[model samples]
Target: MSEALALFASSWFFVAALLAVLSDAFLPLVPSGTLVIAATLHLSDTHTSPFLLGIGVALASFSGDLLLLKFARRGAAWAQRRLERKPGAASAAAHLLAALETKRARTIVVARFVPGGRTVLDLAVGTTDRPPRRFLRWSAVSSAVWATYIVGLGFLNEHTFDTTWLSFAVSCLAATAISAVIARVVQRQRRLARETEAVEPVTVS
Candidate 1:
């Protein structure tokens, strides 16, 4: 308990957390959300403020997203070429483009929860003809939502359960389950969109 409190109270710990969440904007498998959850759980009994941590994490993630968006916008052609070389990324980018056209904010928020979706969507948005300000507004919303959800999960679990491991385990399981469901929904939406596009007839005036 003492060690956990010491680590959570250290300034370096929050710095590392910010970096991890920031890097996760580029790396899909960084487990940034999990790190936030763990930190929240550990800091439950400490003087460290979970609300402040969540805000810091959200801002860090928002910064990373904007940075990536700028890179994608400047290197639009290069980013598109690279994404095309990867089948999964290419498919995701296509769906994200379609989704963005209709449901900008919701798509951004949903994609943030789906593994690897954020990177693809960010690149797609950057390369599109849409206004950058729109992406910026929606990205901020998604980041705040993500941070709040992860931190709240950990905080509630910690207070509800006496055993530390049990709380952590339950929180992780819940997070994973939610992630999986969102991914499945995204996949289904993409499939339906593809079929509709294929069936639609093209007309030349």
Candidate 2:
């Protein structure tokens, strides 16, 4: 138990967490939330504070979001053109942009929880002239919320289960299930919105 605690407390584990979170910003395939939950579960019983780890994860994720946003802004036209070539991606990007136009705060925060929505929203927003400061404000909020939620899941499991591995596994599975459900809900809502928009003009005419 002492050796396990020591390993969890080591600098390498924290660094790995940061890298996972950062890479996840650009690569949706990365299971960054699971890693964060694992880290939190492992360190939950240790002297090291889970809140501190959450903060680190938040900062790292925010940095990655900022970097991607900047890059997207710089190549907005090129990115848009490429997205246009892919019908599915273009439709998703359009939905993100429309949502951003209507409810920037809600979209930003909700997208962080939705699979593949983060990158699409960032790119969609980048194509616009949205103020950098405004984006930063919402981006920070989203990152903090995501970090807190994932870390909280770990802590919840830690408190519920006697075994560390069991707690970690449960937390990860829960997170995955929640993410999948959220993604499906978001996608369904967007599709309905698109259908409504399409029918509105016809009904009006």
- Write down the TM-score of every candidate: 0.90, 0.89
User: Residue by residue across 131-186, what tens digits does model 2's lDDT show?
Assistant: 87887899999999999999999988899999988998899889889988999999
Model 1 bad stretches (over 4 Å):
1-10, 200-205
Q: Please give the lDDT score at residue 22 for candidate 1.
A: 94
**lDDT of every predicted structure (CA atoms):** 0.85, 0.83
- Per candidate, the number of residue pairs that clash is 0, 0
Model 1: per-residue lDDT, tens digit, 1-205? 8876686566565677788889887887898887777788767455678889889989988998998888988999988987897788888898788777888889999988998888888888888877889888999999999999988998899999999889889999999999999999989988887898789697999
Top-scoring candidate (lDDT): 1
* TM-score of model 1 (CA atoms): 0.90
RMSD of each predicted structure: 3.0, 2.6
